[model samples]
Target: MPDKDAGTPRVFLIRHGETEWTKSGQYTGRSDIPLTENGEKQVISSARLVVGPGKIINPSKITQLFISPRKRALRTYELLFDEAARHKFEGKVEITEDIREWDYGLYEGILPSEAKAGRKERGLDKGRPWNIWIDGCEEGESPKDIAGRLDRVIAKIREIQGPYMHGEKPVDVVIVAHGQILRAFARRWLGFEIGVKLPMMLEPGAVGVLSYEHHNVDEPAFLLGVNMAESEE
Candidate 1:
């Protein structure tokens, strides 16, 4: 059980389930895709295992749910919580652009290998490799832009949890978004800049927890490498 007296707040960052693009390792930004059949099965099992009573995500404790303004994310959110849980949530779902996937621009709908090959052909990868974090895409938003947008989302999270931070009621939020943006959001949640080489993997249908150490919001931290077996309890 969590320390209620410590005034801890948590955010459950969930990557949307696999899509055709995701299965093929294609960049899926701004292209609104649906989940594959396997992806739906995977999310159903995961949701039952990790989001019920005493689970990693307790539906009753969730205050707000932010979903990416994409069908993939909205569908994932739908599958993760059952009708009962959704009713308990009382219409807290808000589809926002803030949590959308990184704008891959010219690289959209292509694989990373293809992007690299194209850059290499243009002699753009001559130096230190084409890093999306630093170099960005030819027509995409920069790392700085991602940082700024996510910072606002984090600020809203803090504001939402503020009233419950004094040990009154535990507050929890959920974000259903894409892989790259959620991973970057996790890094920013811990006060780190986006990286050219992403530091972590947030697999499709995976759930990650971000919270403050010792209930101090100033000491934000990621619950790294959490074991799902233990979370099942």
Candidate 2:
């Protein structure tokens, strides 16, 4: 019998592991923080659970990898794949700013409550609270700015997967990036407006899958859950 899962491609969206700012609930855009010790442990454990042959993220099948420019995200990528696994994607990896975290601007290194208070004190968002999705940050990127860049990334992914969708070859793509940007990418993957609040969240050192339904690239959908493979002894 023919393989039922042929042709359809999968995109693995991975959020980088924790930093001190992430632990403290601070906005960590463009700060280039390194992962905490616990953060490295988290990604190492996650790699063992989700990556390998016959696993959710099989390295041999991956065709492309887009990584954020931040050090924390780069560290997560290093921990997720060993030297042997890295050789599998020799010419396919890209370190792009397009996948970097949202530019939090003046809100960088501050908590949400602090950001809100600052905005209020500045005579901004007078009646309502500050929502990053809608209001954005001072001297930072707006929803439109984010959408423009992410849309380009999405287009590139689609272009890469288009020719392989009906073939027997695997066109799995991987993205290693920050939490907020990955969430936004998911929203845009399904043609959602960035300004609209979506109840989506990605914790540090976690992975989410995006794929099409019925082997049709036009039908983009999220894999809400998947059973993980047991770790090797």
Candidate 3:
């Protein structure tokens, strides 16, 4: 007999591997840059460690995948799972704009320091330094805009996971995207407002996990630490 709690579904959030802009601390949004050679290597190594049968992210259990349309993110997904592994969820992959990086607009391709200086020169931040969470980009999507789209994605995830929460099967969803957006997605997954300062970070090639507490869909929470399954012989 299967453990009744085993059916609780989970969402795996993955940030794409490093790019030149990422390595240089630039705000890369909508730039469509490909991953660096090291970035490809990073994803491949990560797959070996965390993705496979019995691993933290068992590819066989993943029923759906939400990916950003950016090439870097697309490439990360390509490297994260090989052809045979991806075949396990052939038609479950969705490439969507909703998961793309937060649009930096005038600040795109610039470093955070440069953005802050620009905002200060423009007399925008007035009393405080420019924080994307609160002040958002001048011509880009605001916190409200981000919440709107992420909310849609979160709704779809809940709808899919609801039916199998108490069943005997496993249902895991995967998301591949950029840093800021994935972090924001996790924040929204727990019903938090993104307009306030949240000291969260997801590095390039990193992964985070979110799931319901005690198999209750109404009680979403982050899995801070999970023991990795031993590699199969």
Off by over 4 Å in 2: 1-7, 227-233
What would the per-residue lDDT of candidate 3 be over residues 1-233, giving only the tens digit for each residue? Answer: 74444557889999999999999999999899999999988888888899988788888778899999999999999999989987777899999999999999999999999988888788787777677887678899899999999999999999888878764456789999999998889889999988755788887888898988778889888988766883232
TM-score of each model, in listed order: 0.91, 0.94, 0.94
Provide the overall lDDT of each model, using Cα atoms, as 2-decimal numbers. 0.84, 0.87, 0.87
Can you give the lDDT of residue 47 in candidate 2? 93
lDDT of 2 by residue, 104-174 (tens): 99999999999888888888987777778877779998988899999999999998887777656778899
Order the numbered candidates by TM-score, best leading.
3, 2, 1
Which order, best to worst by lDDT?
2, 3, 1
Better of 1 and 3 by TM-score: 3
User: Candidate 3 clashing pairs?
Assistant: none
CA lDDT, candidate 3, residue 146: 94
Off by over 4 Å in 3: 1-6, 230-233
